[model samples]
Target: MDKPDLTRITTLLLDADGTLFPSEEPAFGASAAVTQAFADRFGLTGDFSAEHLRRTTTGKNFRTTAQDLLSRRGISVDSAELEMWVAREKEEVTSHLGEVLLPHPGVLAALRTLNRRYRLAVVSSSALTRLAACFTASGLDHLLPPADRFSAEDSLPVPTSKPDPAIYQSALARLGIEPQQAVALEDSATGVESAVSAGITTVGMVQFVPPGERGDRTAQLEQAGAVWVTESWDRLARDLADSTVVVRT
Candidate 1:
């Protein structure tokens, strides 16, 4: 992959979960319960481990992940039932947001350094409410702020989830910036695809990836067209500061 043209970039679009904030512990537990509920409802049999469910659903929006999970087990449910399941999962997860969600190590310092030199915005596949909750809990909301945050829920008339460029495109349009003027930091394959497809310079963040899985995760991000990958936000912050020398004319 080519080096990101940070010299020309004036804005940073960041992913929320797994990028800035660690995955919520409650959400992980809730997802396991929801997955088991589906298995019981469908009378399917297998080892439904939390890690297994997480791997299956990571990087996907709630409804999409639910559908995929059911489809993988050859279990079909009506739209209302699917909605009910998703709502249950969200309720359980969000209820414990305060106790479970926290910012990743060095993410706040990195954001502070980046915010000094470039316009910062959060572009997340999560719903706006969920994104707000996490940011508020982690105090990242003060830096990114509500006005600069974009979410899958913001894509209206037609829903555009990650792996689609619509959310990133909408963010750029709203921020009044060109794709070339922005750099995106993402942790998941879906998030990388969204930013790369939107014509932004994309960096894959692997700090949150489990130690054993970093190699595969890094390869996945590279395959998704990330221009660069790093496991250290502190290093990335310095690199960005060093590379962003060209002023926007």
Candidate 2:
């Protein structure tokens, strides 16, 4: 990939779950419970522990994760049943996030600095309700407008999730900006693939990741096409502000 032209960038597309805030522990805790319930209902076998779910489906929405997991087990449910489970998971996770979510360290300071220079929008694989809850809980709702938050699970006509690139494409179109005109901050390979596949320059954020896991996660994000990986929002903010580009292999 070529170096991104920072001068041409006009928008910052942010991923919500781990990138913008540290909600994975609580969010995945709720998700694992809901997923286990779904698995029990369908008689599907495999671990649905919180860590396992986070490892397997960190960047995927509940709807996609449910279908994928069930399909792997050769279990299929009717649309009504699937919708019911999806709704339940969304409600449980959103509620959990609303109560426990907080912005990643330095996220507020970074956003306060960057928001003034570029258009800020959330581009996430989460449902809009969940994203809304996250923003409100983390005190980020004031920085990014509701209309600017794009959810792959709720914003599109046919709900989808990352690594599909549909959400990033939709977000770019809605913002009326070319792919090169925006920089995407992601924390997972699935999200990096989505943004990169849509032709946007992607950066990986791993501040919320465990220290021991960050090296592996950083490599995964780079392999998925992130131009850079960072563990500090302040560093990212400074780099962007100074128009410094650092590509890590």
Candidate 3:
């Protein structure tokens, strides 16, 4: 597919995990460990789905909300206990976080090139701290410069997040932008839905799901109204190149 016209595009919003890094396995495994720790402390086993839904929908701090929701649902965890459990999750994830981060080859150059032409922001459900660490480890730290990132941490007291479109809208709002003039790049069905619902052009950053995984997230993303679905970073580069996008004069 031909890349979207750069002249017509303004802001660029991105999802962090699979689109910027390698695959979700490392982050997923790290997160799974955190959730397991939450369960262990709370004596709960079935809160995974609930926690996932809460994070995706509300962008709450991962462990904090997991602990809160577990307690609300009658599980035995408390804020103090959750704190210790969070420490464990944090330590474990920090040690292996670097492993999950492998940016697509030439991505730095593409980002640098695009930086000259467009404003970039991260519109992920992930905590800003972890996402910042991943970007630093992957060498995009210089380009992304953690401060520019928009994430769950930015969701504020209410924990509002994606699939509801608030996060993307927040980014554009911060930039003083209109949705029709910007684009949101995502790798998940929920994210695409959130972006499209906000009236922003959405692009699906392709990712891998294990075989026999009943549902197809790509189709779901398309249904949610993505303007493009791709696994190729080269395409993003070419899109930028085609438009000769330069920082607005």
Candidate No. with top lDDT? 2
- Candidate numbers sorted by lDDT from highest down: 2, 1, 3
Question: Local distance difference test, per candidate?
Answer: 0.78, 0.89, 0.66
- Model 3 — which ten-residue stretch has the worst lDDT? 50-59
Per-residue lDDT over 1-249 for candidate 3, one digit per residue giving the tens place of the 0 to 100 score: 454565667678888766777535565466676776566655766646433543342323456456455767776645576667656655666567765566555667777777777878888776666786788778888778766688754454544556667777787877788886687888777778888888888887663343333146567667778776765566776755666443542
Give the runs in model 2 whose Cα sits over 4 Å from its true position: 1-3, 103-105, 244-249
Model 3 residue runs over 4 Å out of place are 1-7, 46-91, 155-157, 207-215, 240-249
Cα lDDT tens digits, model 1, 14-80, are 9987778767335566667777877788786775566775665566667676666678778778878
Per-residue accuracy of model 2 over 93-205 as CA lDDT, tens digit each: 99999988765548898998888788889999898889888899888888987999999998999999999999999999998989978899999999999999999999999
Worst 10 residues of 1 by lDDT: 152-161
Question: All candidates' TM-scores?
Answer: 0.88, 0.95, 0.76
Two-way lDDT contest, 1 vs 3, winner: 1
How far does residue 2 in candidate 3 sit from its true spot (Å)? Answer: 9.5
Q: How many backbone collisions does model 1 have?
A: 0
